[model samples]
Target chain A: MTAYDPARRPRVAVLCSFNVDLVHGPLSEALAARGLPSELYFSGYGQWESDLHNSASELYRFGPQVVVVYPDLRDVVPAFGSTVPSKHEAEAAGAEAASALGQGIETFLSRAPGATVLCTGLTVPPVNALGLLEGNAGYSWRSAANAFNAHIQDLSEGQGRLFFLDIEPVIQRVGWTAWNDSRLWCIGRMRLARDAYPHLAAFWARAIRAMLTPRRKCLVLDLDNTLWGGVVGEDGLDGIQLGHSGAGLAFLEFQRAVKTLPARGVLLAVCSKNNRDDALEVFRAHPSMVLEASDFTAMEIGWDDKATGLRRIADRVGIGLDSLVFWDDSPVERALVRRALPEVLVPEVPEDPALHAEFLHGLEAFDTLTLTREDIRRSAMYREEAQRKTVRAAMAEGPPEAFYRACGIEMTVVRADDFSLPRLSQMVMKTNQFNMSTKRYSTAEIAAFMRAPDIDVHALRVSDRFGDLGIVGMAIVRRDTSPWLLDTFLLSCRALGRTIEHGFLGFLSRRATSAGAGLRALYIPTARNAPVKRFLDELGLEPVPAGGETFHVTIPSGLVAIPSWLTLTIEE
Target chain B: MSDKLLYETVARVLRVPLETIDIDSSPETIARWDSMAQVALMLEVESVFSVRLHSDSLMALNSVRKIRDALVHLGALPEAP
Candidate 1:
């Protein structure tokens, strides 16, 4: 609904060892197809080293948020093409090249702390001195390239913003002959064919988009031919084909692939037009079923239309419908859902079951830049939410405070540090309903706030009898003003409905009172943030008439009190 | 391929006006048809005609007439056309 703003999109800079200026056109086209139009800057030919080391270089002046570093192995180690190098020489060349590139990247990171650097692994030269036996040769060009890539991979381990994109798989997918254009290389130093740039650029564009946008949280799958070989209700559990051999093996491979998604914080749910009992029987009795019934966060196995089923699944999981990717094998059902709910991503299901798993691999919806502890434990948190909801429903007979007291709610507030920056930035970008001000601050901006003397950024973690909700809320306060200004305040949707919002505000009020400052928070209304207005009114902060888009309120020091039932912990 | 289609493809790849190009146009004649545009032109030619250009003639196909002659020599286009 918002107008397209090119300046707001992510700025990308490419620094390659070869003439890859041709990539700019196709790379922009690929990103535009993903609905993320980016501003791209290409460094001059073979000027990566100068652009990285010099702080006043044009690359730094461009102020890129994402930098792609592509250094070809043949360009870095020229001797690999002419002579069959020894093991010691190959390893030395690889190490020296990696170290130099790594040093330049480290310098670039120092200049742009918030920028993400995607350094590529070296691709093996298609032709080498050793010919067909090169891979078997102990210290051939392949090993040298591997050594360089391994070192590049190691550089990204501790560096939070640095990522290593392996290009070998892409080259292998497109084939070496088609990927490289010897004629173009000889004519204009263009190492890649004109058409091959888009295939390689899609991966980079996805990674950049992940850094800026919230990732899809759930994958809604259909039953029958989609999940397995046959319909459960019609064919019966025994007749369904799913195992480690024949056509069943392909279904098993797809199931195994879906099962791994949960580990990466992607919830799996079922939306099928089958009897509930029949589907449950297959999940419980099937010996070769890779995904158990317990793995699903929610399931809608009824005779309802898939559009309605998908809505219920999204509601039960507390995620937006736009965050759900529906996979159905039937063209009729896929077309119906596409017409009914266009926001839901419906990837074309391959008719051949053998290609199903491969089709799943090409999905870019769930791509992310980093994997945090909170991400790995997200599914478990959702499972715990279901239990908490059941308990809350039973306690509905009593007053709201009774439920809060019975749950033994505990809240922890800590100053934002390097350890909590990634999750904190993610919460800032994704949390919408309880968010006030709704400013999408990047990790670098949050770090800048942390370094400022007058600004204090706090990360709130909630836990109870259910489980530990890791860093579910955050607030940024500017202390230079008379009444400390709350620049940003938000709580994760999963942590809501538990009165944690009240406790979080009380913690902030107490912190301000201790510093002899009253708190003034802004409640900026967004399309999805109408729920945040009532919470501010309940705290009884008198509104200070503001002329701008935000509704400003002044919080009295002793007015907002922390409830006795809620235990509060403050970490230094 | 028709001469009109060839000139249109060259103009589009070079990002110039169609009225500015003819059979005698070359890199020296058009400012936009630099080394980069030449590479892009070769690629567009290969894809448009569905024929691969030999590596030896990649640099030699400078003028529009020469490219047409090479395509004819490869039997990609009729000699008279």
Candidate 2:
């Protein structure tokens, strides 16, 4: 299936404390705001406890990719009254409440280990107790909430797939008095304010997008008002608003915000309709400029239209337009790019430059929930790809084989373990084009495979002089008898043309021969598996072409040749 | 103004058209105004009028007129609009 297919939008289960009737409407709108779609399933009101414990419950039946457990103050408290209960009674109730909630969370994780769980912390009311003696009481409303939220945070740290969403910060941002409307709570049992739905939706959507959707990899910026307060071509380096002083601090703050993206593997590029030398001067000469020339992965600074510039940046970065996010202060340029390149995300910069930093922070577009080791080094990987391209450009026209040989590509095949299993399974699920047998397995299932005696699972880590692309391929072999069957085999698209698959198959063949069995790899013909289809045939395997999916090479018979460009090493 | 406003709030809470509601509509006649809807309607009316209905009055919210009369007794509704 093509990337960004609507049907593949991550499935999310919103197990809410209140009636999710009104909240569901804004949840969809929040996803639309980020261009991430979700198939949301709402559990019955307050069924989070039952759904978490029962395997046959709706939570398991729906099989959501992400579960958002949102609880309000009303959900935990059976009754609300202005008259405060005695200090002794309050203490008893608080301990009981925390235990029940903690137990429910523990049971849910035991049943659902692979699915991501994002639980919202309880929001403390503006006034916890009646008069002002809440501080004197040991089990005050605030204290109870603090204990419960802290427990959730601890549970999140303990559990492999759990995160505590601190709703208190959001409430404080909009003021608790304004956020907790007395009208909606008393009248409709709608604990969360209707007006606050948009904010809550936007907040939770960032987390859901991060967990389920691929984040924007490349952030394309305009040099004029985007990177600085004024157009660099006209303002010149010293004159541009990018320093510690008034009006200039705003651009400095904006530059500081842009610098954080690269650390998280978001590639930074400059696309502007200005002289390249003029833009370079700011990055070079400006003492206060937080960004530098080396910081940007690519630069397309010229008088060309932004759409064309964005295309060149995308091409240079080796990513598609859909993965690029364009930031420009000019509304006309943003509008033109929006109309021309509909795939690219061009967020509108505030008219006032002072709000630009806050605007970028509010977007929350480029971040995700889980950051793997591969993800942290992704920007460097693309820069390496750019380096490879430069080398290709410098090579006085020859066969591409000489370039591949000189690149010093190496592959290490190792057995799957706890550390590498997550990436291995993720590659199995996300990699589409180069996959021979498009088998998708969860981390839990991969663990099961690792435990099984007859099944062998191996993953490959490839690297070159430029950088390392960690754990980009996975292979699962079922070795019960002679002619061992290839259960699941796939390589990431990034490692495809480099012929890492040859080393992968060669390693599997050696293992099969050592086990005193013949080697057989199967290719279930899929629309995207054409590349694999050709490689499987050329491996010198006996083609049982008449069947649906069969190719076998007996030991001392099947041709197993490792490419000279790649140094293959098998790890214990 | 408060009388008309009270009727509009009840209609909205019950998910019924304003024209379809009056002082006589109760849970027995309105299919959607079940136990949960009754609690919702009473909460909404109490919030709109800035007056809390008694726990006993929760079951007595049988008809729109009864609700109006309770609001009037609580001095929440203006004198007969």
Query: Fraction of reference contacts reproduced per prediction?
Result: 0.36, 0.00
Model 1, runs deviating above 4 Å: A1-9, A132-138, A391-466, A471-572, B1-12, B15-21
Give the chain B TM-score for each candidate: 0.93, 0.89
Best by TM-score: 1
- Per-prediction DockQ comes to 0.44, 0.12
TM-score of each: 0.79, 0.74
lDDT of 2 by residue, B1-81 (tens): 376798799789877899987777887778988866776677667667878777668667678888888888888876566
Per-residue lDDT for A177-210 in model 1, tens only?
8899988878778888766888878877877777
lDDT of 2 by residue, A493-528 (tens): 888776788877877877787777867765666778
User: Could you say which candidate leads in DockQ?
Assistant: 1
Residue A515 lDDT (model 2) = 73
